[model samples]
Every structure is written in C-alpha cells, then in structure tokens.
Target chain A: MIMLLNECKIEMIRIFRNPYFVFWSLLMPIIFYFIFTKVVDTGVDDQELWNKHFLMSIAVFSVMGSAIMTLGIRVVQERSEGWTTWIKVTPLPSSSYFIAKMVGQSAVHVFSIIVIFIAGIILNGVSMTFVEWVSSAAWILIASFPFLALGVLVGTMKRVDTASGISNIIYLALAITGGLWMPMEILPKTIQLIGSWLPAYHYGNGAWGIIRGQFPEFKSIAILTVYLLLFMVLSIYIRRKQEAV
Target chain B: METIVEINNLTKEFKGKRAVEDVSFSIKPGEVVAILGPNGAGKSTAILMMLGLLHPTSGTVSLFNQKPQEQKVRERIGVMLQQVSIMDALKVKELLALFRSYYPTPLSMEEMIRLTGMQGSELNRRTDKLSGGQKRRVSFALAMAGNPDLVFFDEPTVGMDSTARKQFWEKVRQHANAGKTVLFSTHYLQEADDVATRILLFNEGKLVADGSPASIKQRLLKKAVSFKMDGHFPKEQFLAMEHISDVSEEKGRIVIQTEDTDRVLSSLFSIEMPISDIAIDKGRLEDAFEQLTVEQGVS
Candidate 1:
C-alpha cells in the first residue's frame, strides 16, 4: 500500500507538470468551449439546449484528452528511456506501478473536467442545479476509462514520436466525429456511423445525457465498457508479445 | 555454502538471431565479479535474464536458490541498468523514497545520500532537470536504496566524468567491502582488472573466460623479456628456441616475446655476456580481449 501510494504521488506530479497535459486537456477544451458558445454561435435553434450540451461535450473532451495524451505519452517515454527496466528489478510489483498510473491519471482527468466545467460556467453564464453539475462531472470521469485504455495501447509504442503522432490523429478523429466540436446532426453520415463505435462519442453522449436530466443510454454504457475491455486486452497481448522475444 | 546466483544453460534469442547462447555460470557471496565484454557481446541480455527482466529462451536463473521472479529473491537485489532510466518529473529524494519502499529493509534517506554523495539541493531538484553526472548519482542512490544483498550494474559509468566515475567506483568498492555480492558489466578491461575479484569475459555470446584477474591475464596474454645487451647476442639461438615466439632488437635492447618469461630469463643468465636493466612485460588485458573476440569467428 505504501509503495503504490508513493508511486501514485510521483505519477500525479509527473502528469500535472507535463505541458502537453496542460495544453491539450485543460486549456484546449476550455478554449473550444468558449469559441463555440460565446463566439462561433453554433447555428442551433435551441440555444439554451446547445449551451448545456456543448458544456458537457467539452467537459468530456477535457478528460479524454488527458486520459489519452498524458497516459500514453508518458508510458512510451518511460519504456524508451529504460525506466520500465529499472523499476522491474526493484521489489515494486508491476501491478502496483499500473494501479498508480491509473489512479494518478484519473486524478488529472478530474482536474481537467473541473477546469473545463468552470470555463463553461464563465462563458455563457450557464446555470444548472448542483445535481446536474455533479452528475455531468461524474459521467465524464467514469466515461474516461476507454480513452485511458487507448492510452495504454499508445504506451506500447516503441518511440515517443510515433505515440504522439498516432495519439494526435486519434484525438482529432475522436473530437471531430464525437460531436465535441459540432453537433452530431451536423456530421456526415459516414463519420457519424464510425463515431457510433468510438468510445469518445459515447463518452460525450453520456455527459450530455446527464445535463439533459436523462439517464445515460444503456447501449452507450455497454459499448464504452466493451471498448475499455478491448483496449485493455490488446495492451496486455501486445506487451506480452514484445516480452516474448 | 550456497551460491548467490546460479544459471544453467541460459540463452536468449531475438528474431532467430542469438543474443545469448547456451552459457552458464554461478556467483558466490562477497564476490566482486565483472562481466567484461565488448558491446553486443550478450552482457546485458544475461544480466536481464538473471534479474528476470528478460526471459531466457532455454534454461533458468536462480537467485538466492529461488527463481529470480520470486518476491523473496526480488527483495534481496538492486539494479542500475546500462541506460540512465530514472523517472523524470520526480525529485531525486522522491525517487529514492519510492524505491526504498519496495524492499522490506531499505537504507535510510541519510544513508543513501552519504553513500552516493548526493547533496541536499540536488535531492530536492527534479530528476529530469539534473545534469548527466547528477542523474547517474541519483541512479546509483536508487540502486543502493534497498540495501540489497546482491547488486547488478550494467555499464553504470557510461556518461560520468572522471570525478563522478572515481566516486562511483569508490562507493561500489565500499559496498563490496561490506560483503555484498556486486556484479557489474563493462567493456573496459582495466576496470575489470582493477576492481573485480573475478572476471567473466564474454565473446560472441559465449563465456570465453572466467577466472581471477591475474589468472586470466596470465593465461591469455603474452609476456616479453627485454634487456640491454652487454655484448654481441645470439638472436638466432633465442628465436630458434621453443619457448620464445619472437626475438628482436628494439631501441638498442634485445626484446624477446615468449609465453614463459621466467624460462627466457633463466636462459639469458646462461649467456656468456652479462645483461643490464633486464625487464619483463606481462601482456595487456586488451590483447587477450581482442584475441578472444577476433578468434571467436574461427573457433
């Protein structure tokens, strides 16, 4: 327990200190929120509904960015730099290291959510009941699991540049198709079709559902769960394959 | 007495190419052993297998008479890999504390500092921001933090300057004196000769030689008997002798290359003319290392 906590403390510090985490997860989502709600004037007839929906979109966006970029890139860096090799020889078990990363990155995801949530309130004077606010945050945090798993897949990459490049591509694709930048109705049919299978789309939908006083769709929950397991299994399989050599 | 480490027929292959092949050795307690080899000579692979970082293709490694992966074995060892792989964004002190928490019995923070010669300000500074030498010191401290009974260092001084290098060996010697079994890998023959009680020389993924430093040098390196001749010398007589490999005059001195310098010296005394300033040169470890690796292809 002490070992896990110590590892977690360092992991949290490392994630929070990262400039990429700050720029992509916290700053970018807040920027996008303000641009859409305050300036871009997303051409929806029901502006109030759009405001609440957009707020949830960006909040989910914030956590997903942290989950993928921060977790993925740092793991790759550690692998290439040989920190993984050093730690293995210590008495610290691999499970402790893994749990620490999960817990620490989850904390970063929460921080990103709150920062973007505050930004949403400031941008449009958006008002909601305390339950709506808390539930939206909770939904986004829980929905970040699949993205975190995707980050693990990215972590298995051999080089940081490849991890960074692949993650950016996935991030942009997730944001665009998931309706975080625009409403799902505005996207092309093919993209929406692809988005339906992506955890990021369901991630935003769940948060948006919470803000609209509706339960997150059971289908969305199940799909995100499947993705989480899929990525987790993939990461394990690839890691084992790498080690078998 | 039990062996601290035992490897039987250990081998590792990457993509059908041999990285380590059918090699075996055991380590005893309180022995400072150097795994001396050129780069890509399977030094790191063997160490990784012993540390349980890399699985062997065939065979096994046991530490403290238990599998290397056993928690009981893990708690008794520390490692500093060839690469400087300390976690970035952590204070040096934080890393030490984190690694120390892994083992059941770890050195105190003050003791770690004293052992590695790390200062207070450096400890507080983040690891990524440290200079190369400082980072190595931090790595060394992390390796010692567990107060391990057995330690493995793979090319630990690759990037350190002279002072840091000197300090590193000093601390390593200190640990060895405390009766810890320390195994380090290096390409520097002089370092192996100077520090190790026993040297394991690897060539082309094979354990080419293993013995005391003196014995290895004596066995593989040629010695030279040289003298300033007092009169005309019978060079042909010396050259024709079975003990002498070559007899030539170098810088006005008769230099005789031979496997047995004592025999050459004895023969010199039998000469009619007296000799002055007689000297013998034991061949360098570099030659033996070169001889081993170059001859590996043919063997």
Candidate 2:
C-alpha cells in the first residue's frame, strides 16, 4: 500500500513538472472555457441557463481531454523510452503502476474541473446552489471513468508521436460529435446518431442532467459502463501483447 | 559453492527467429560474471529471460532456487537494461525513492548516492537535464538502491567516461567483495577481462566459451615469442621445430607462434644465434574473444 502511494506521488510530480501536461490539462481547458462562455455569445435569452450548460460541457471536455490525451501520451512515451521494461523487472506489480496513473490522472481531472467551474462563475456570472455544484462535480467526476479506460487503450499504442496524434483527433471528434461544442439539436441527424453511440455523449449527457436538477438517464450510465469495460479489456490485451514482444 | 542462478535449455524465439538459442549456465554466490558477446549475439535476450522480463520459448530459469517470475525472487535482484530512457521530469532523489519503495529493504539514500558517485546538485536535478554519462550514473544508482543480492547490468557503462567507468568497476568489485552476485552483459572485452571472475562468451546465441580471462586466452591463442637476432637466423629450422606453429620475421625480429615457449627457447639457444630483445607475449583476452567468436561463425 505504501509502495502504491509512493508511485502515485511520484506520478503526480511528473505530471505537474511536465509543461505540456500543465498547458493542456490546466491552461488550455481554462482558455477554452473563457472563449466559449464569455467571448462566444450563444445569444440564448436564458443567459444563466446557457452558462450552466456550457460549464458542464466544458468541464466534461476538460476531464476527458486530460484523461485521454495527457495520461495516454505519457504512457506511450514511457513505453517508448524503456521505462516500462525497468518497472517490469522491479517488485512493483503492473497493477500498482496502473493504479498510480489512474489516481494521478483523477487528481488532474479534479483540478481541471474546478478551474473550469471557477471560470463559469467569475467570468460568465453563472450561479448554482452548493448542492447543485457538488452534485454536478460528482457526476462529472463519475463520467470521466470511461475516458480513463480510453487513455489506457491509447497508451498501448506503439509510438508516442502516433499516440499523441491519434489522441488529439479522437478528443476533438468526441467533443464535437457529443454536442459539447454545440447542442445536439443544432447538429445534423446523422451526427447525433453517431454521437449517441459514443461514450463522450453519454458522459456529457450525464453531467448536463445533473446540472439541470434531474437524475441522469440510466441508459447513458449503462452505455458508459459498457464502453469502460470494452476499453479496459482492449487496453489490457494490447499491453500484454506489447510486453510479450 | 551454492548456485544462485540456473538456466536449463533456455531459448527465446521472436516470430520464428531465435533470439536466444538453447543456452545453459549457472552462477554461484559472490561471483561477478560477465556476459560478453557482439551485437545480435543474444546477450540482452538471455539477460531478459533470466530477469523474467521475457518468457522463453522453451526451458526454464531459476533464481535463488525460485522461479524468476516469483516476486520473492524478483525482490532480491536489481536490473539496469542497455537502452533505457527514464522519466526526464523526475528529480534524481524522487526517482531513487520510488525504486527504493519497491523493495522490502533498501540501502540508505546517502549510500546509494555515494556508491554511484552522484555529487551534490546532481541529485536535485531533473533526469532529463543531465548529460548522458550522468544519466547512466543515476541509472546505476537506481539499480543498487534495492541493495539486491544479485544485480543485472546490461552495458551499464556504455555512455560513461573513462573515469566514470573506472568508478563503476570499483563499485562492482566492492559489491562482489561484500558477497553480492552480479551478472552483467557488455561488448567491452577489456571490461570482462579486468572485472569478471568468470566470463561467459556468447557467439551467435551460444555459450561458446566459459572460463577465467587467463584460461580463455590460453585456450584460444598460442604463445607468441619475438626476438631480434644480429646474425643469420635459420627461420625454417625454427618453423620445423616441434610445438612451433608459425615463424615470421619483421624488422630484424623473429616472431614465433608456439604452443610451448620452453622448447622454442631451448632450440633457439642451441642454434647459437645472437638473440637480442627477446620478448614473450602472453595471448590477450581480445585475441581469445575474436578467435572464439570467429570459430563459432565458421562452424
């Protein structure tokens, strides 16, 4: 248990020391929140309602981004750098290494979420009761689970450059198709259909449901859980294959 | 002597191409063993199998009388691979602490730093900013942090300067003297010659030669005797002598390759040639390594 926690502490230091991780996970997400909420006016008469919905969307986006892009890129880089082989020879179990990464990534997710929420309240004049804010934060945190699995899947990719490129493309596509940038009502019918099948859509929908004072759809939760399991299995399979090689 | 490591018919194949062929060896406690081989000779592959990082296609490896995959066995060993790039963002102290946590008992931080010769400021610096040699030193420090009973180092001094290499050998010697078993792989024949108690020469995925440096040199190279003579010398007479393998003249010196230098010397004195600058050269480990590896290639 101490070893696992030590690994987590080291991983957190690594993440924060990395300028790229800081930019993407903290700065870029905050920048995106400001641009979307404060600068780009949706002209919706219910300004507070628009602020609240956009805040949830960007929060989900940042959480997923950090989980997939930051965590996934770092894993692939470590593999390419031969750090994985070093860890394998140690008494540290593979499960412990992975758990450390998950915990560290979750910490970063919370930071990103809080930063975006502060931006919503300060810049866009968005208001919410303490219960609503706490519940929304909780649901957003829960919604990030599937993306954690996706990050692991991306980490198993062969090359760090390839992993980063693929992660960026996937992050943008998921955010756009899932109606985080625009409402699903505004996108084409085919896009909405495709987005419905994506884990990101469910993640955003769940968080948005919580913000709107309703329980999230059971179908969204179920779909997200299924995606999480699928990605987790695929990640483990690919990682085993890599190790065997 | 108790065997600390045992390998039986170990082999590894990657996509039908054998990386390590059927190879077997055992190491006793307190022995500093060097695995010497050229590139593609499967030195790294063999080390990987012994460390339980790679599963052999056939056969088994036991360390400390337990399977290599067992955590108990793994905890007793420290490893530094040939081509590893560590987390660049981590400070040296943080990296060492993380690796130290993996073992049940580890050396103190000050001891690890001192053993690896990591000085002040270097320990506080991030790994990425260190020079190549400095990074290699840090890697070596991490390997010794666990205070392992057995340590595996693959080309540990590749990027190190001559001074650093000397320090590394000294540390390995200290470890062995303290009853720690070390198994390392290197392309430097001189390193094996100077540091190893027993050398395992691998050629084309086979353990071609295994012995002390002097023994291997004796086995592979005939004694070389060279002398300068002022008077006329009968080269054919020396060449025809028993135990004399070859005789050649260069710059007024008669160089004789022979299995027995005593007989050659006796024959030379009996011939009454005015010999000057008589020098005998024992065969070097490099010659033995070359001949052994070349022989394996031909056969």
Candidate 3:
C-alpha cells in the first residue's frame, strides 16, 4: 500500500507539472463555461435555469476531459516511452500501475470539479442548497469512471501521436453529442438519438437532475454502468491482443 | 554449488519464426557472464524471457529457483533494458525515490549514486531535461537502486560514448567485486572479452559456444594453412577433410581454412607435394565470430 501511494504521489507530480493539463483540463473548461453561459447566449428568458443547467454541462465537460485526455494520453505516453515495461521488471505489482493512475487522475478531476463549481457560483451568482451541491459533485465524480475507462482504450493505440488525435475526437464527440455543450432539445433528432446512447449524456443529466429536486434516473445509472464495463472490457481486449507476453 | 540462473531449453517463436531457439545455460554467483552475439542474435529475447518480459514457446527460466515474474524473485533482481526507459517531468531524485520505494530493502540515495559511480549532482534536474549522457547515468543509478543480488543488462553499452562506456564497465566490475552476479549481452567482442569471466557465444537463435573467455577466444581464433605453390596445387586433398571449411586461392597462395590448422599442416606434410613458404594466419577474432554466426548458426 505504501508503494502504491508512492506511485500515486509521483503520478500527481507528473500530472501537475505537465503544461497540457493547464490548457485542456482546467483553463479550457472554465473559460468555455463562461463564454457559453455569459458571453455567447445570455438572452434566455429564465436566466437562473440557464445558469444552473449550463453549470452541470460544463462540470461534466471538465471531468470528462480530465478522464479521457489527461489520464488517457498519459497512459499512452508512458507505455510508448518504455515506463510500462520498466515497471514490469520492478517489484511493484502490475495491478498497482493501473490503480495508481486511476486514483491519481481521479484526485486531479476532483480539483477540476471543485474549481468549475466555484466558477459557476462566483461568476454567475448561481445558488444551490448545500445538499444539492454536495450530491451533484458526488454524482459527477462517480460518473467520470466510464470516461476514464475510455481513456484506457485510447492508451491502447499503436502510436502516441495517433492516440492523442483519437482521444481528442472521442472527448469532443461525447461532449457535443451527449448534450454537455448544449441541451439535446436544441440539437437535431439524429444527434439527440446518438447523444442519448452515450454515457456522457446520462452523466450530465444526472448532475442536472440533482439541482431540480430530482434524483438521477435508474436508466441513467444503468447506461453509465454498461458503458463503464464496455470500455474496460474493450481496452483489456485490445491491450491483450497487442502484447506478446 | 547452487546457481543463480538456471535456463533449460528456452525457446521463443515470433509467429512461426524462431527468435530464440533451444538454448540453455546456468550462472553461478559472482560470475560475470556475457551473452555475445551479433544483431538479431536473440540475446535480448533470451534476457527478456529470463526477466519474464517474454514467454518461451517451450522452456523454463529460473532465477533463484523461482519464476521470473514472482515478486520474491523480482525483489532481488535489477534490470536495465536497451531503451530510453525513464519517466518525464519528474526530477532525478524523485524518480530514484519512486523506484527505490518499490523495493522493500532499497539502497540509500548516496549508496546508489556511489555504486553507480555517479557524481550525484543531476538529481535536481528533471529526467527528460537531462542530456543524453546524463540520462544514461541516471538510468544506471536507477538500475542499482535496489542493491540487487543479480543484475541483468541487455546491451548495456549500445549507444554510449567512450567515457560513458568505460565508466559503465568499471561500475559493473565494481559490482562484481562486491559479489553481485552480473549478466550482460553485447555484440562488441572486446567488451565480452575484457569484462566477462565466462562468455556464451550465440549464433542466430542458438547458443553456439560457452566457456571461459580465454578458451572461447582460443577456439574463435580462426586459423588457416596458407602456402605458396609453384606448381598445380592439390586442392582436393584439403577439400576432402571434414574439418576444413574452405580452400580458396588468393595472390599466388593457397589458403586452407580449417578449425584445426595443425591438422591441415600435418596433412600437407603427409602428402607428396612441394609446399613452400607455409604460414599460418590467425585471423581477427571478429571474423571468427562472424563465421560462427553464419556457418554454424543452425543446430
């Protein structure tokens, strides 16, 4: 357990030191939330409803980017650069490698969630009850797992250069199609149909439900669980197929 | 005496083609054994199997009488593979600390540096920010962090400068002095000859020769019987010998290539032919090793 913590400690340092996280994980989501809510479309009749709704959208956006881009691309880089092979020869158990990445990246996502939630409160004066705030934050944190599993799928790419591109596409597609960028009502029917199938849609909707005095739907939780299992099994299958030993 | 490594019939096949054939050897404690072979000689494949990175199609690799992947076995061994195996953004000290924490009984920072012959000043810099030579030194330091009982280095001197190369072998020698079993693979003939107590000469995917450096060098000396013949030479006589590999004529001299040059010379005296200006040319050791990899690679 001490060794695993040490691994997580180094992982945190590595993630924090990387300039990429600043752009994609932190600054981009917060800036995009402000632009979409305050600058781009501010003429909504129910401004408070819009503020609360967009807050969930951007919160889900932030965690999803961290899970797929930050966690996923780091895995690809580490594996391609020989860190994975190096660890195999060490006394550290193989399970610890994955667990450390999962735990460490989740911690960073927690920070992202808190920061974006703060942005919603201070910037838009969006108010929520304490219970609603805590429950929604908890929902977003737990809902981010499927996307983290998707990140591992990206890590299995044959080349790091291509992994970055593929992961970027996956993150953006889920964000836009899953109604995290805008509500599914504004999107065409075809996109809405596709968005509903994505875990991102249900994850964002689960957070939006808490503020409206509606707990998350059973179907949303079920869909998210299904995607989580799918991503994990797919990533494991691809990884096993690629590796010779 | 107990052996540190016991490999038996270790074979690895990539698809249908073999990368490592049925090769076997054992290493005792305090012996510096070199896996000497040319490129694609399966040295890295064998080492990978021994370290549990590769699976043999049919064989076993035992380190300290346990499976290579066992955690108990892993705790006692250190490996330095032939690649840029370092994490980026972490300072050298952080990387060292992180790797050291993986082992239960790790060497101190100062002791790791001392054993690696490093100056211990590069610890403050990030690993990716270091120069090539500095990165190699830090890697060497990481390999020694566990204060391992058995150290495995796969082509440890592949892309090193003269000073770095000399320092690496010097560090290996230092470890050998402390009774740590060292096993390294190298294509450089002189490296094996200078550093190894025992040499395992591999050709293709098979181990062709195994013995002390002196004895293997003697066998790999590559001798030939050459004579200046004024009349028609009896090439058929030398060609018929099972020991003679080649009989080629060059610049008015008939050269009879054989593993046993004395036999060629004795046969020449036994034949009723005028053989004058006879000389034995002991070719360079590299040529003999090259011959081993090509002519005797199979079986």
Candidate 4:
C-alpha cells in the first residue's frame, strides 16, 4: 500500500510538470468561469441560477480533465513504451498498481474541482450557501468513478494512435453533452435525453442539482454507478487479453 | 545445484507458423547460459515466454518449479528485454526509484548506480538525453536493482562498443560470482564463448546443442588445418583420404577439414609435399554454430 501511494505521488508530480494538463485543469477553468459569469453576464433576475450552472459546469470540466483525458493519455503512452510490462514483472502487486491509478485520479479530480470553485468565487463573483457549496463539491468528486473506469477501458482497448483520436472524440462529446461547454437547458431536447445517459451528464447535473439545494436524482447516480462497474469489467477483460497476446 | 528454470515441450505459434516449437532446456543456479541463433531463430520469442510476457501455446515453463506468471515466482527473476526504453522524461535516478518501488527488497539507488559504473552526473540526466550505450548501461542497472536471483539479459550488449561489451561481460561474470542464474541471448559468438558456462543453440525454434563451449566445439567432426604446401601437392590424394571430410586451396595455402589429422598427414607425407608454417585450427563455436544452423536450416 505504501509503495502504491508512492507510485501515485510520482504520477501526480509528472502530471503537474506537464504544461498542457496544467492549462486545462487549472488555467482554463479560471478563464472559462471568468468569461461566463463576469464578462458575459446577461443581466438576469436570478443571478444565483447563473452562478450554480457555471460552477457545476466547471466541476464537470474538472472530471473530464483529470479522469478522462489525463488518465487515458498516460495509460496509452505507458503501454506503448513497455512500462506496463515492466510493472508486471515487478514484485508490486498488479491490483496495487491499478488501484493507485484510481486513487491518484480521484485526488486530482477533487483538487481541480476545488480550485475551479474557489476561482469562481474570487474572480467570477459566484457565491453560494455553505450547504450548497459542500453538496455540490461532494457530488462532483463522488461522480468521478464512472469516468475513470471508462478512461481505463478505452485506454486499454487501443494503441497510442487510436487512443489519442478516440479520446479527443469522447472528451469533446462528453464536454458538450454534459453541459460543460454550454447550458444544458438550452440544448436540443434529443441531446438532453442523450445527455442523461452519459456519466458526464449525470455528474454535471448532480452537481448542478446539489448547488440549487435540490436532492440529486437517484436514477442518474444509479445509472452512473452501473456504467462504472461495466467499464471496470471491460477494462479487466481487455487488459488480460492484451497480456495473453 | 538446483535448476532455476525448466521448460518442457514448450511450443508457441503465430498465426499458423511456429515461432518456437517443442523446445526444452534447463539452467542451473550460478550458471550462465547463452541462446545463440540467427535472426528469426525465435530467441527473443523464447525469452519472452520465459519471462511470462507471452503465454506458450502448449507445454510447461516453470521458473524455480513455479509458473513464470505467478507473482511470487516472477519476483525472483529480473529481465532486460531486447527493447530498452525507460520513461524518457524521468531522470535516471527517478526512474530507478520508481522501479525500486516495485520490488519488496532492492539494492539501494547509490549501489545500483555504482554497479552499472554510472557517474554521478549520469544519474541526474533524463533517459532520452543519454547516448545509446548509456541507455543500455542504465537498463543494466535497472535489471540489477532488485538484486534478483535470476536475470534474463536479451541481447544485453547489442549496439555497444567493444569496451562497453567487455564491461558488460564482466558484470555478467559478477552476477555469476554472486551465484545468480543468467540467461543471455546474443548474436555475438565470442560473447557466448567467453561468458557462458553452457551455450544453448537455437535453430528454427529448437534446441540444437547445449553444452560447455569446449564440449560443443569438440562435438563437430570437421577441423580446419591450414599450412603452405609446396611442389605438386596431391590435393586429390589428400581429398581422397577417408578421414578427410573436405579440402580447399586459398592462395598458396591448403586448408583441410578432417576428423583424423594423423591419417591425413600420412597421406600428405607420402606424396612428398613440403609443408611450412603449419598450424592446426581447433574448430570454434562460430564454426559449430554455422554448421549446426546451416544443417538445420533455421526457418
């Protein structure tokens, strides 16, 4: 367990050292929040709605960055460079190696969400009650599981070239459909229905609902949990097959 | 000494063609075994299977009487695969530290660096910045980091200069001195003759010969004897001797390949051939390797 955490700590350092991830996870969220809430503020009666919507959207974006894009790309690169096989030969238990990835991403997901939320408060004039803030943050962090599992599945299924292409498509689709790129209410009804089925949509909506002091939809949480389990199973099966080859 | 690895009728196929077929060999503790073969001779494939990176299509491979893929079993074996790439972005020390985390007990970072003869400055450099030979040295250090009892070096000295190659052989010897089992695969015949206690010759996916260098050399019947021959040399006469396998002439010199040197010499003396600068060349591992692979026609 100690060794596993050490590995995770090293991974965290490597991710922070990369400028690309830092831009997306830290700088982009602050920029997006500022533009949405401060610069493009369409004078509306309920400013609270705008605050909750964009804050939740930034949380959703955080999940996409840490859970999907960052984790997926790293796994593909590691496999291509034979680091996976190198790990397999070690005394480090395979389960520990895998669990460390999940733990590491969860930490990153929560950290990014907090940073975005605070940036919104400081720069975007976004404010919320203590209960609303706590629930919204908790929901976003809890919702990272499904995306992490999905990232592992896709990362394991393809090589570096295929993974990069597919990850971009998947990341963009989730960002748009999950309301990270736009307000969910303004999207087409067909897309709204499709969005409900995506883990990212549930994550975003759950955070959005929590920030409004409304109970999150239990159905979306259950559905996301199922997706998480399904992807984990698929990832294990695919990775074992890769090793067999 | 107990055997460290044993393979029984191991066979692996890709698509429909056999890569390694019905191969069986065993290596004992504190011994160095070299697998020598031409390209496409299935040497790398065999090593992969041994390392449990590839599953055998049929048959059994037991490292220390346990399956290679078993976690407990694998911990005892260290590998330097043919493809050597560390995390290019990580400094050498950082990479070593990460690999060290994987092992329960490992040599300290300082000791590992010292073992590989790496200077202090080299430890701080990123792997991508290192020269090819330096990268190989770092890989050698990583393989020994765990202080594993068994190490598989797949073409460990490939692309290395003469000095680097010599230094690597000394390391191999050091491992053996510490009672470590080593399975070295290489195309360099001299490496096998110099370092390996037993040479495992692979031809087209089968174990053709396994013995000490001297023993393997002696098993080949043909020897090359070269000398200057003078005055109406009865090339035909020497060629006809039943003991003589074949004879060839090269620019004022006669090279005879034969099993019975005395009988061939008797025939040559009878023909009144003046011989000067005569020397009997003991057959080498290179010659035996060629003869075996050519006869077998490694696919």
| Best model number under DockQ | 1
By descending DockQ, how would the candidates be arranged? 1, 2, 3, 4
Interface CA RMSD of each prediction in angstroms:
1.1, 1.1, 0.9, 1.7
TM-score, structure 3 vs. true: 0.88
What is the per-residue lDDT of model 2 for residues A77-145, given as tens digits with 9 covering 90 to 100? Answer: 888899888888888898899899999878767777888888888887788889889888988887798
Calculate DockQ per candidate and list them: 0.82, 0.81, 0.73, 0.58
Each prediction's RMSD over C-alphas, in Å, is 6.1, 6.0, 6.4, 6.1
- DockQ (0 to 1) for model 2: 0.81
User: What shift in Å separates residue B221 of candidate 2 from its native position after superposition?
Assistant: 3.9
Tens-place lDDT per residue, model 1, A1-245, is: 87788778888998888887788777887887778878886678888888889888888777887788888998999999998877777778888999999999888777777777777777777889999988888888888889999999999999999999999899988999998888887899999999988888899998888888999999999999999999999999999899866
lDDT of 2 at B150: 97
Instruction: Give the clashing pairs for model 1.
Output: none
Every candidate's lDDT? 0.84, 0.84, 0.85, 0.79
Kindly report which residue stretches of model 3 are placed more than 4 angstroms away from their true locations once superposed: B115-121, B228-288, B291-299
lDDT of candidate 3 over B215-250, digit per residue (tens): 787667667878888777667876886778889999
True contacts kept of 3: 0.89
**Residue pairs with backbone overlap in model 4:** none
lDDT for each residue of candidate 2 in B181-247, tens digit (9 for 90 to 100): 9999877666777889898988778888899976654555567789888777787877778888888
TM-score against truth, every candidate: 0.87, 0.87, 0.88, 0.85
Query: Taking the tens digit of each residue's C-alpha lDDT, what string does model 4 give over A150-239?
Result: 888777845777877787788889888877878777799999889878878887878877877788899888989999999999988887
TM-score of chain B of each: 0.78, 0.76, 0.78, 0.77
Worst 10 residues of 1 chain B by lDDT: B290-299
lDDT over C-alpha atoms for residue A13 of model 1: 90
Candidate 2 local lDDT, residue A98: 87
List model 3 lDDT by residue over A166-219, tens digit each.
Answer: 888888999999898888888999999999998889999999899898999999
